[model samples]
Target: MDFNKIKEMGLEYAEKGKNAALDLAEKGRTQAKIVNAQSKLYKAQRQLGALVYSLAKGNEENQPLVDKYIEMIANIEQEISDLKASLEPDTVIETTFEDTEEAADGTADAAAEPAEEKPEDDEAKTCPQCGAPVSDDALFCNKCGAQL
Candidate 1:
């Protein structure tokens, strides 16, 4: 109940709060670095794979060097996969590739591309009375007529 003691206690709390904030900021910066690294790795892997595919398309003579690049790309992909798995152990990552649209001759259109479907979560509220799905603004459960 001394003025000096109260000021010292307040200062201590302030310092603790400041340190916690700094720690959180450092964590944010580290997370950003991890995201940037993952993006760069993916870009590099795609570029190398494209190069190998183009080489194989042009001639058979470039097979040896293309094989080498393909091997390196595979290793890079494996490493990226392992690192991603470790970084996001609790996250479920799914990749869905759609079939390219076809032409009149039953062949795929040269310009047509496969689309990726994004997974979406249902945001509607569920009724506790009968476990029925309901709109978020509902005042009563539609099935059981129970008040929400």
Candidate 2:
């Protein structure tokens, strides 16, 4: 009965369907099939809007209408979930850019600070040059030949 939520869910389904259709096109599927799928998705969204309006009118005998709307909403959610599951793994790497003034200030602060002594527990077992794990008794890294 929450019209806004219903509308939002409807829009979400439409977007997911659009994306799925586009994915099909990218994989060389027929244009007619994609367009047909898009048309069905749009119709479903419109039906959802109509259902919401009908349910909001305070008709006591509209329970079946409400139930149908709920079922449609669930179907849309499932479609979106399926589409998301079919997508390939994507990695997002984010890089931050600092203002020139901030960078210069940070650099100056770093230069003024004295290096801290390493903790006793933090022994140089790993290769400092390549960071490969090494034995505690090793005098030089076997992988990079760098002295500990």
Candidate 3:
């Protein structure tokens, strides 16, 4: 029934929303990096394959170039692995003395309210090639690199 309490509740919800948006943005950036690394990895592998094939046809070998490609590919793979690991959802535990005090005072209901999240719609579109969820705005599937 207090106006100040209602205002505080609104501010809390707003803060939670802002934090969730920032988290989502960070996740999107990580996913984009993974996709870029995947593209580079594919290109390096293809080049290595071509070089090996040409060398076999000519009965020649370039150990140095081959080694370079191998090293580059390994590094790219490691980067992709790290980025993908970062994409894994994080578990955040946020607790403070104020939270404990509020709970003891039976005012924790404001904090207990669930954060807003976009739900999966019944009509959500999926990638035809990989069956992974794809946003309507996406030109390519994030999971399997399929054209959407």
Q: How accurate is candidate 3 locally (lDDT)?
A: 0.61
Worst 10 residues of 2 by lDDT: 91-100
Count of clashing residue pairs in every prediction:
0, 0, 0
Angstrom error of the Cα, residue 39, model 1: value is 1.2
lDDT of 1 by residue, 27-105 (tens): 4543443454455345445554564565467653445544554554464445445434433425332320011111111
Ranked candidates, highest TM-score first: 3, 1, 2
Score every model by TM-score: 0.38, 0.30, 0.57
Give Cα-based local distance difference scores for all models. 0.47, 0.47, 0.61
- Candidate 2 per-residue lDDT over residues 2-66, each given as its tens digit: 99999999999999999878666533422332333344345446655564565476552455544
Worst 10 residues of 3 by lDDT: 107-116
lDDT for model 1, please.
0.47
Q: Clash pairs of candidate 3?
A: none
Ranking by lDDT: 3, 2, 1
Tally clashes: model 3. Answer: 0
What does the lDDT read for residue 77 in candidate 1? Answer: 48
In model 2, the number of clashes is 0
TM-score (C-alpha, index-matched) for candidate 2 = 0.30
